[model samples]
Target: MTSASMISPGDILTRAEIRPILGGSAYGGICPAIEERNVILYSDHEVAKKFGYHDGWLSENDTLGPIFEYTGAGKSGHQSLTQSGNKAILQHVQSGRTLHVFTRVGKITGTDTKTHRYIGEFAIDEEQPFVPRQGLGEDDLIRTAIVFRLRPTGEFDRSDSDTISPAPSTSAEFVPLTITSDMLEAAAVTRNAFTSSSLRSRSNSASLDAAASGKIAPVQAVNVSEFQRAASAATTVRRRKALLIEAYVNQLEAQGHSVGSFQLQIEGRTTTLRTDFFDATDYTLYEAQGSSDRDAVRAAFSRLLDYRRYVRHDGLQYEPKTVALLPGRPDPDLEALLASYRISLIYQGEDGKFSSAF
Candidate 1:
């Protein structure tokens, strides 16, 4: 095995070949080759399935390109981000280290030695890196897992069959919901938007604002507005959705309806689900979307269906109404889709009043 820096993408090596070069236990999935300034990630999807887990899959190309979801270390219990390889994977960018991935291909005919296929280099997705997931542990119990979202930085073995499949439809005759006291605290937790990209744009905008107000030299504002504009454009979708939720909550409260959100922990799942807003007085559950476009409306509809199970809150004699809240009325086709599922639609009109369809 050559040094880590010299190892190119698609270079396969065995544990025996990697040990001397990487200086760590060759058996571990996350190996830090200290001398070479590289972090080698070994993903064995086949083995993961045998343990009742499915991860280390490649996703189709989207706007940001392909993403590989890799499960972090630890076979049982909840995995911590601040410990071991999880920390290394998180801070690899700041430490100036490269992430090289390898997937177990097969075992040598009869021996215990397994071969790996070098996939290529990857970087943690800056927007969202760690995703909480549920997987069975070694003890056959459900445990919390951390999935690291990795974006490819170079050419990888795309011919592998481990492509990420779309999530299965959530429609079922019976969906279980586990009530937890942490619902309010979890719902209040803000989504993280402080990425490096957002920070750079904020600094530039602050500098430009100071310059425009005569607090700094006018020349310092050169080309800063363009960067600031780009940053604002990047966050438009999230901001729009947030604003819609806030306005709807206020409207509900003004109408004598108690508005709140819930973070639900489904039975047997480590990941939790959060509702956009719930009308306690009227017994309505809402799933809001910023845009009424086809994709956005479809997503909101799907989520609303999944959340219907939560409408049967404790002490309630009947299930609450499921509603899809949109910034504006959806097209006739989309409205029909919601109606087919018996989901009510509520949209804000030009007059600032909400229009509803039951």
Candidate 2:
């Protein structure tokens, strides 16, 4: 990817492919914008401060990643999300827009000669999506911030694109350097010295230029307290979603339909795809999106598509109807959007009413 010195909230068209924009520039020559405005430039560096887990990236899995800590839509007491200054940033995620991501290379703070590695375009991880979590700002005020999970659009774009190659967390143990026969023979006489020397060399190279590598620096222990708080918040969201699924399942059962959760195991695949509800009578698979937000809805759509593909690949006896089940009615435009894709939407009402958009 061509490494532009800067990119902002609305710079790229949502339809343009990422490769052309970035020219496959993985890392290096690109620094976390040495500055940021509305569009978050996430270069693997943790902020210079020791306190808050304000801005950073967490690649939870190859497919699921999270960006922290932007305030969410003004639903809760998250004033930051509602501020006019951040409106463009919030819309990018809420509207299912992709953003450019770069990881830090050398120290990027307090200096003008910093650089970043372009990771690639990332869409917010749709499955768990964004969660409102407890976080303290630099000012120490209690606030709810939005943490968006992101997933790369294509393969890793940087030299260090191994995603977890060196392991991103500050807590990552010093991974020993791989030894070759040539180095082994020379170091045999002084193994301890060789090992320590090699480790230091690798660490130094990873830091990339001790002078420019800002103390804001690369990945931290992922903020222990923040990790715990995010985890707890996710658990709560899951529990609430489960209840909504149960309610929907009960409603279907009462209507004399036979429905059950379905799990599909594909040969040679370690992970099995699971569906929220499967109706045997109609061979319909329902995917549950606990929230009515855009990312969640879009993520549910992606999952349903994946399930449909995997089930077909599994050679099921019958084709299945894919429906997205939501806990509450989403935006009216979202319903129309779902219909446009030929995916049905069924949502629960505030009074526990259910309606379907087919």
Candidate 3:
């Protein structure tokens, strides 16, 4: 705890605790005055007042997970993070300091000292975390504000939420959706682009007349039956990963294996670390990663290692066999890496069957 690890998420230090560690009692939400300080105590009010609200309006939209947004510096027209008071905060991440996040636990109007609750600590998720997005300024002028996404580090060591349920019925087919341009047009038509029923009628008549005269290209009716990936790329990746886990779970259950998730509350931590699924019949804890690429595989490795400690903290009678449910077969190097750690790797194939990689 001597280094940055000392400052975990969900840690609310009293002045005595903080002053000794941070070397000063002058810490506040954002103190540009102390440029050398790595720790910044943030409250939601300050976020709303200083940079976020274009019109002094602070809502839940202010902070999403790992994403704390603010109006970019500048007032004239388009804004940039470098131009805003938030510039200091964004630039501070370059120092590689953990950002301590606090929210009001009592009345929102309560003072920072009394109301602030430590939610978690965050780190810069991307090399460049700030990007200007379209927004309105306090003056209601069309402007750009910087959106920053910060990933949560295990600073808080909070209990993990239970995210597993029973396996989805394998009797039902898992399908991917397909989308077509004509389907988009049909959706647009149903949404009513015209001003009134009269306009709609006229537009329909025009469409029929154009087809009858053969003056316009005929649009074939499109059936959008498959699940069109209507989500963002991040969402799509995560969804596909989730499906891989679900399919694996279904496969395991089809073989009469008892499956449930492991939610162990480590004695010392505020949050719990959970495994994706556990086999009661054999006491196997499965870690399902929605990603299989290098970085994700690396993270999954760390999680498995930490869970070993967590299991110890739980002091359960029997240790569970730890297995990772990966999206695909790992590269040889990665497979060897997992084997070196004695972690079992189970992957789904292109044919959708789950297989053991030993």
Tens digits of per-residue lDDT, candidate 1, 214-244, equal 1211222323343334434324454455556
What C-alpha lDDT do the candidate models reach, one value each?
Answer: 0.61, 0.44, 0.45
Number of the candidate with higher lDDT, 1 or 3: 1
**Residue 258 Cα positional deviation in candidate 2, in Å, after optimal superposition:** 1.8
Off by over 4 Å in 1: 1-5, 19-24, 164-320, 323-358
Arrange candidates by lDDT, highest first: which order?
1, 3, 2
- lDDT, candidate 2, equals 0.44
lDDT of 3: 0.45
lDDT of 1 at 221: 31
Better of 2 and 3 by lDDT: 3
User: Can you write out model 2's per-residue Cα lDDT over 1-358, one digit (the tens) per residue?
Assistant: 2333344322332212323443422322111221221143343334423334333433233434333222232323333322432333324443333456655456436864445555556654434333333435556754434444445555435342323222222211111111111111111111112222222343322321211111111212122232233344444344345546656766776888766444454443222234555665566777876578898899888877777654432335554778888888888888887788677988888888788855
Q: lDDT of candidate 1 vs native?
A: 0.61
**All candidates' TM-scores?**
0.55, 0.36, 0.39
Quote the lDDT for 92 in model 3: 49
Q: Which predicted model would earn the best lDDT?
A: 1
